[model samples]
Target: MKNIARTLASLLALALTHAPSALAQASCSSDGTPQPVAIFERFISADCEACWSDAATPAPSATAGAAVLDWIVPGKAGDDAPLSAAATSDALARLQTLGRKPPVATDVHTAAIEATMPARLRVAHGMPFNDYLGTAIAFTPVQRAAQRTGAAPAAMDFYLLLVESVPAGTEGTKVARNMVRNMLHGTLDKRNKLSKSEQMKWMETRSMRIPEGAQAERLRMVGWVQDAQGRVIAAAQSTCR
Candidate 1:
């Protein structure tokens, strides 16, 4: 099993390029140069046993990913969050090039996320709520099945919550959704053995929601995922006022 996993990881490594440094992360929306969302990272050291305790590669690592960058995005605020295709594409492309462990340890870096974050962002999870200074997009989870019949999920489900309402004239809500979440969960390639990047990617993939044209005032949504039997997986929450 170990040999197979290593082989696969090597194969993946061969296909990937060196990851861009955290500095490569963008500071603004494509059109809006001002609106910036804060970035918190927790890259675990190679010697950190806590980092790998969760699994072969460890999803919820006990070791912390380093909190690297936090910058505010400057921009004009509109009511609804703008969905950017370019931003999404760039994010996906970056994920395809993972060469090493990122300075991100999921929940472990949330505290830094809130303190350093310039704008309100619905963080993925693990940071305390009181520390959050700005708007956040939190949500609960819902479940879906695989296209294959009798195909058990290779791994657990991922979820995001939209408890916080993103109102009009906010600094950078759209940037938060696109950059922060995608940065966390966009790299999701799976081999027999898993890595932290793959797990985070899975989380981002399944978790998210909008209240179906609901006005953005004190609005809240839950992003979560469940099993075939409707059992809860994991969830996060963020809201707007």
Candidate 2:
């Protein structure tokens, strides 16, 4: 378990900041859009202010930092759950009062949020015990183990999805670039021929030394989905990232 956490942490860090050779050898598909990786990072409260964070005045990342946490955590599930109407009211008021910046970026849509989030936050691994927007927030079991052990998780408890960035109207051949399926055009119909090959390649190169000056794009999408129970599902990108 300790090794698992260590490995997972290393993977996370590598995904964020790997050496040049570690990236070039990756079997990037012919597709072009930049894929987005689903990293098991944390999100704090400050970013989700709902003003600059939402559409109209977007931040660089429509889906980064605290927004990720809000997406994974359940919102309103229980009738007995304490409603935060006051909090909501205050938040909304702040937004209106602030007079947001001049269209920094569009607000994050609900669909984007959903897609960015996992199908469901599994609770099997001692994770937060609620569905998206549910209550009883806490870390998943494997997540806790990793935290406790102060190591990367050997067995992560979620699916890490990699996404690709495509232009608004690019379809067909170009669409395959995205790692995850978008709502409008969910997943690629054709099976990915590259993923398996890449895996095999990864196995072979796990021990190989990276050559000099071979870094690639900023990112290649890959993500980890964790359920409330702490079950981890790993889903690498088929086409994009």
Candidate 3:
């Protein structure tokens, strides 16, 4: 019996060593991420102290199926700015992408995720480790969308966001926020059809750095896919366990 137990343990260890990477890490909860029908983005400058605590700052809808994101654009004050530590260049790029100038204090934008879009986007992340988090996003084309004959491959832009959920009162703010801390971007061309008539999908897995002072437990991920026209096709937000 001792020898049998030893053999079983050895087998188990060997199996684990060869396990798939996905199996080695946790994904979203069993219920999966939120399927947000609309995305709301709030922009604030790190140098603006009043903006952080202002009650007029726009907020995401309380209605279900909506996702809100907060971006801290780097202020002209540079590192000396109050919230400079949380400011990111990605925010600036996003402003450019949206054709919006940086606001002196705060601004808001909204985009809808078409419920009838033919593609699906899923985002997930594993538990944080070593100041890094494993995150992934996948794009899947429905049967008809994938089987379009002789159609040009569609251009797709993928965005994965790592956000810190801050309570309304935590930072003297009157509203809760999903603060964007880190981001990953990629582009893909949709396949005209599934490979060998099987599943055709685009996916990317990456390690996102956890910013200093970010509470890992409060971290979550949001992702969306945009077409060439910059319309959101699908959006998802992770639910951390």
Model 1 misplaced stretches (Cα beyond 4 Å): 1-153, 157-201, 205-213
TM-scores of the models, in the given order?
Answer: 0.21, 0.22, 0.82
Q: Which candidate gets the maximum TM-score versus the true structure?
A: 3
lDDT of 2: 0.25
How would you encode candidate 1's per-residue C-alpha lDDT over 1-241 as one tens digit per residue? 5445444433322222122122123111111122112223223322232332333331223444322221112112212213321112222222333233223332223221222111211232211122221111221111222222233343433322233333323433222111232222221124322345323223121212222332323333233333434333333333221
Give the Å error, residue 118, model 1.
30
- Superposed on all Cα atoms, model 2 deviates from the true structure by an RMSD in Å of 19.0
RMSD of each: 21.3, 19.0, 7.8
How far out, in Å, is residue 191 in model 3? 9.7
- Write model 3 residue lDDT over 1-241, tens digit each, in one string: 5445444433432332223243444545213455788889999999997898887787667766778999999999999998898899999999999999988999899998864457666666666566777676666767686577434347788888999999988876787879999988878664422255444567666667788989998998898888888888888887745
- In candidate 3, which residue pairs clash? none
lDDT of 3: 0.75
